[model samples]
Target chain A: MKKVLSGNEAFARAAYEAGVGVVSSYPGTPSTEITEHVSEYTEIYTEWATNEKVATEVAIGASLGGKRSMTCMKHVGLNVASDPIMTLSYTGVNAGMVVIVADDPNMYSSQNEQDSRHYARFGKIPMFEPCDSSEAKQFTKDAFALSEEFCTPFYIRSCTRVSHTQTVVDLVDRVEGPAFAPENNIPKWVMIPVNARRRHKLVEHRTELLTELAEGDKYNKVTMRDKSVGVVCAGVAYNYVREVNPEASTLKLDMVWPLPIEKIRKFSESVDKLYVIEELDPFFETEIKAAGIKVEKLERSLCGELSVDAVRALFNGEEYEVESDNSLPFRPPNMCPGCSHRGMFYAINRLKLFVTGDIGCYTLGLLPPLQAINTTVCMGASIGMGHGLDKAAEGMSEKAVAVIGDSTFLHTGINSLINTVYNKGNSTVIILDNGITGMTGHQPNAGTGCDIHGGNTPKIDYVNLIKSIGVKPDNIRVVDPFDVTACMETLKEETAKKEPSVIITNKPCIFADRTVIDAPYFIKEDKCSGCKICTRLGCPAILWDGEKRVAFIDETLCTGCHLCIKVCKFGAIEQRSK
Target chain B: MKLDILMVGVGGQGTVLSSNIVCDVALANGFDVKKSEIHGMAQRGGSVVTHIRVDEEVFSPTIPAKSADIVVSFERMEFLRYADYYGDNTTLILNTQVIAPPSVGDGSAEYTDDKVEEVKKQFSKVYATDAISKAIELGNPKIAGMIILGILAKAVHFKKEAWEQAIKDRVPPKTIDLNMKAFDLGYNI
Candidate 1:
């Protein structure tokens, strides 16, 4: 059967067809839907792990228990799972294990554009890259065969361009592969110094064998068109290269890592001019050059994504424009109009506190109206950084605080929160529990009381969780962030305390929680005192008519939450009656 | 045989949903289709764009600049932002709706009043619709994208049944009637 599916859906379908018994992932953009789609298949037991590290570990345990297991994450997520992944390469697997990592080339929703192929090389694992949805499905299925063949973890990399793109894919029936029984092999399973040292040699030998297999693999193929220019590309870049210059001879490598060394050399010798067409970093170009092949570098920036026009320009012997802006007004992502974080951030800025922000929708607080955040290193860095900053300076503890989302706090903030209490750091932490992971399209978290399968799970009580971490019950404050006056009062009270404290900003994301009714708020022009205080909240619903000098709310956008109404002391903004 | 479409709109405007419907309709009609979309933070009121290409055989998910056969814009400014995607050969189906960006609304910049006129002058076939107003007339603002699809249905030679089926397949069961009505309004307009 032929079906139109996104690369993510195709990947999940392919995993099911490959007889994958266990699938685990933490929700991240371009990668979240893979796990979500997999959850639809009852044949495959799937989960959204607290973080990528735990996801990788769960998949590893499943693989060791003789089931085909896979874990998925974005490029930055591989950084979190690198510890286990590096060792898993030595331990190998009882059943085939595939770690699917989606890279965002343009940093679409990610913090960085680090290549996942580098992780494959670092861990001594084979990596596959697919150009379209069909290949995404086919390569994913092939990944299992490659994993079990070498008894090593295999990486299947998808970029935002690949994962989010929809294309035609041919569906296949699910294959029932032989399941291995868990055998207690002490030398192979145990990673003690002696065992690890011997396994490391096998890891090296396995890479060599994988490279030999890749040399003749169907994924690494050559298309001879014009012998003058031979371009080597992978993943989405391969599509760009093919579309732009179909006449150019091409060496397309679906198996990116443990590269086809012999085929690359043959292709390099056959063509007059060899070029590497890839987005972001020159991963293929650097490696092909190291393999002693003479290649010409296409004049393109390593930053951002490669467009079809960019590749076409290179093929047509024209210089691609470095910068071409039509002067469109910038539309950076902002906090939603009725977002609870806006009130909490507005309070943070009013108090002039240095806040270490974590990854989530709240990180948007670093933008113009509420420039409240000082640092945003990574996930769970907010609490750890808050403790460090407070200890570094004498009075910084009084002025500095940490803000993290419910999902992110659950991912890594719990450990850091426990550290603050254990180390006796007096840093104030704010857990912005928006109920779901808002940034990644509202995936259910531990606090959301729903699993990946949408089954009702026990919700994590933030107040109790904080108390268990050794903060006093009195010190842990639960406040409705939508109530600006009350939220500000709580913020002031908590920062004044000498002991460590937490203020949980409890509210659900308006978009995610459909139960939240949004009665339109209209501005009373008669009572308007053009103070522009409500405008400072940066609510998209609150529009200031420059001519009238009075603010009016766009009824369609205004959620009856009415944080703007509380900020308006002049009785300007009022919610209309139901 | 090739129809390259570039759909641009603000996040939460159902731009992704519209593109998905078009792709599905094309697939149902036996055309090879590929579409590239942006989701995530962009879903939070940022500019969202999708490049959808359909033909007898489609290779790339993205459409080349200055080569789109048709440009379906849900918002006016976002359409102008991607003006590079269309040329003289391109037919523009613009939803005459403007949701000013923060910079423009804050007096830092100006919203171009002559955008429709400007686009008309550049592209030969420019169909501007008051889809936002049309959607409001139909009693729901969320059906604005469906109205654009109605206009697009006229520009392209696809079966109305296929388009309707695609909409039904993609949208929530409850909103199917409203979306079909919105699509009909757009088709007529």
Candidate 2:
């Protein structure tokens, strides 16, 4: 009964094992795979909802029906689902509804590094963060129980490390949990103002009690060692604190919000110094400090994301250090070789249009060579922000295009597009339909023609959807982005029109769908031209060997999608003749 | 002894089965072993790493990085992540694969082949090897991670029979004969 599981898969197995009857999720990184993993078990009903808010509401309804249900989304997706999340916290729940939210700390596969721990505070729900896959599984199984026990939705928060990292998880959680079903009660389920007002009190009463229960819950544990430095840490930070001062008496919290106040105070008093080591936010530290406990030093530097090295830097004892700085080295994530986004960025940049980008792998379009996108606010904001920027300029500053992924458009971009249509404002929204949601690890979206858990769902035609959203059908054009010339004409046409227009670049994610292209192609170094044209595609596989003064393609990384080949005017990007 | 070791590597390598053998041995040795894996974007040739920790009273699942005694990385390019969990006491088994991150693209930044050597200078005790070449020599070429895992076992007290049993237990029953040989060759390495 032992195996390896990533934090995402472990959550899925935990869902299955928890006897979860309903699993709904909007696929986002560090979160998308949870339901996909849960789907493996035939006992559970799992579906990839079109968007995060819809997924959350679906799960909420399931939970109200007396069956344990769960929904998962990335941190940004949480923003899309925030409306439901905030109110549901007031309505409370029945058979335990768990929401697994995966956060990106370094913005890997995410638009921003908004801390979900703060969200737990905002949503007024208990948030559990597991540092590794094991904790991910255990916490998920524990999440269902805690949700029902408190009669409120429980949050299992995950960071990129915890979500992406594979750890030794005891894989039995999938088979251990029992399927739960609850009896329907309209008075209990309905959230109308009259019933809601009573449920709000119930929610408040539960919150007040949950805070006190945190003091003795099994979720938080204390280990006493030297007792000189009592460090309060949770999630991955706990692992770091344990390593930094293994001898330091520690209070580790798995349930971050509604912190175990009494336990933190006792541990702080017992130890000589108090250092709360949690990631990103000052949640635990602030909570404990508010309880009137004075500490020797508040390690604020431990805020943001903490690597074991950062933690050990504070503790001089045999720390893990890479000696020489060198920025600790970072890999610049780039678009795969044949990325569909590349050809589009080429056109957008060549036209010198001030493009507003949305969250997706395509956001890499802003990187070095391309340097095209002017602004990247958040998910689904491209269209609205683009409209505002364009209207403010009033045709003074060239063409402004809002570039969003198909997944994002479906997530929340439609409303803004509708507003542009209703107001009769001119904003061209280009929906990059890469078939799969690329940024957050290629989770299926409404536009992907596939549902969560591999079900064949009706694909939302971005062109038709926008047309229905009030934009004229003629204003919406489905253009094959692989053809640069066709894209150029469409781009000009969409921008030239003084009305809301949508241009969906229809193509499968070349990396996800390998059949899109085959056989590796590279830039001919001997051609003696570093026009910097191919680099404009912003493909990660293409690198410049500064010493050699030529474009170097990492053959292993290239998908040969031919988007780069099409853009290289010099015939430099020729297909490798095997 | 029961060992729950997470072996991490890129997709083309044998990260799955190598860790499975380690987990299976712990199970066969009657040490209630429970191991799980999440293979996300694995097919995309991205950074792949594992967490395998074997202990007696292992309650919480993750190894907690610094708590890990050994971190076997199939590609040296991903060694930076090891700094999170790898401590002065941890042993590093790395493959000399020079696959660059997505950052080192056409216009973003530049990197040379010597990047792998530049990274090795950062580690505490580096065991570098041409695992791909060794795997090719093993007739499979894909079990490069297994060869690296083989080199890792040299530092730990894992029994050969347990590993053999794990390979036979975890792999498809059809490919058992070949995979067992692959595991044995890895064990010898």
Candidate 3:
């Protein structure tokens, strides 16, 4: 049956269909939903690991124990899992293992947009980039088979556009693949330096074989068409280029790393003008050019995010008509109103202390209005940076708050918190436990009090987890951010204390939580002295009556959180009667 | 003429779904359309707005904000956020809502009654709404966005029948009676 599902949903369904034994991932945008969605299948063990690295390791161990396993994270998250990913590349696996990395182009909810394909090359692993939801489902299952065949970990990379977009996919029953029947190759499995040295040769041999394997793969193929134009594209960019020129000769590669050399050369030789169209970086164009093919129109000059418009510009020729406009139309991305982070950010700013931020929708805290978070390097870096900054400050600045989302804290944050305590650093870590991973479409996390199957994993208590990390118990404080006076007072007290601390803000993210009741606060037209005191909260639900010079609240938006009534000293704003 | 438009907003008075109601009504009257939206991250007590432009032909589902005939904005600072999209001929329907951004430290920017008067300097015409008072009298404080939509329906290109039809089609089966009352409350001025 054909079903309309998101890329993440399809990914999870495919994994379950593959009868994957273990699912481990720390929630981050673009990729978080895959694991969460997969948890719906009761036949497999799916979970939100503490971080991406641990998640990768957990998947590796389970796969070695003869279970199909997979772990996923956003592109930046690959950096956190790179260590395990590299070693696993050498160890290979008993059962099929697929590591899915979701990349965000345009940095939608991300702090940065570093390509993960580079890491795949660095780790000497083969990578697959799926263009859409259906491909995300099928390509992942394909990666698993390729992984077991080569005794190497397979990678499937998808970007935000592919990860978030919904498309139709055919549904089939979950066919549990046979268990990883173990075969002894101690030299292959155990890589002690001497044995590892030997396996390194095997790894090299495996790469050659994988390359040969990659060469015949159905993913990397070309439509031998009009000799006028030859193009190499992959993932979403592949779709873009195709849209621009339907009849243009194309070489679309699913397996990007350790590229299918013979196939590329064949595609390159058949066409006259060779153009490479891939987003972010021209990894394909660079590699093809290196392989001694007279390349024409390589996107050497163009860089950054990929879009159909960009691809259209590259293939601009007589066949493609061009229309140019000089308007520099802009649509800058911004955060929403009544966001749980806003009041907390306002509180953080009041402290005037340096704060290292982490990934999530909360990363928008660095943006204006809430311009409170100081530094946002990557996932889980907040605590690390916070510790580093605290040591450098060396008692000068009163506090350093490592602000991280609940999902990010699960992704790679807890360890950094543990490390900070172990290193005897005096810094505070604020686990912004908004329940769901709001940055990447509200994917569930370990701290969310729920699990993949909607089955609860003992929600790791943030306060208790902080203690386990060896931070002093007295230092940990749970505060509700909405209660302004309490939140401000708690921040003041936490900063004054000498011990390292962990503040768990238990406010539900406004987007997800709808329990709150909003009593309407309409402005008094006649008694209304438009002092504008109510506007301080910046709630979009309220509007200023221009002609009469009075405050008005948009009823539709009034969550009835009633923060405005407290601020309205003039008694002009009052709740509407039922 | 019947219309159905969805405006996304957070807990703020300025961006309370007024533009969508009016545009949806306009579409209901001899118009055809559908829209997709993203209200993510905006509910953080920040300025929020989305455009739903309708005409005889709109191939794509999303509204390209540039040609928006009527721009309903709840906040002053947000004007520049989507400023490039507005043409010189665009009507800027505004609610002089100003909330300090993170960049504006407390007490750094002074506020005065003449703030909207100054803001009107840029726009060809600034139609401001005191939606709060009207909502207060109606015993529904959250009706400002609809009030602005009502004001626009009366003044702009959209016909009133389309607006009523849209409300008729969109209001829930259970709330149909209440909503007709609400629609009249919103635009019957």
lDDT of 1 by residue, B69-93 (tens): 9988788767777767887799989
Fnat for each predicted structure, in order: 0.65, 0.17, 0.03
lDDT of 2 by residue, A347-408 (tens): 88778888888877777777766777888887788989988887788792248899998877
- The C-alpha lDDT values of all candidates are 0.87, 0.72, 0.68
Q: What is the lDDT of residue B97 in candidate 2?
A: 70
Candidate order, TM-score descending: 1, 2, 3
Candidate closer to the true structure by DockQ (higher is better), 1 or 3: 1
Q: What is residue A19's positional error in candidate 3, in angstroms?
A: 3.0
Ranking by DockQ: 1, 2, 3
> Which digits, one per residue and each the tens of the lDDT, describe model 1 over residues A437-493?
889888888899989878999999888878888999999998888787787888888
True-structure lDDT of candidate 1: 0.87
**Per-prediction TM-score, please?**
0.97, 0.84, 0.74
Q: Which residue ranges in model 3 land beyond 4 Å of their true spot? A: A3-5, A182-186, A298-303, A317-339, A467-474, A510-533, A565-578, B1-189
Per-candidate count of clashing residue pairs (backbone under 3 Å):
0, 30, 41
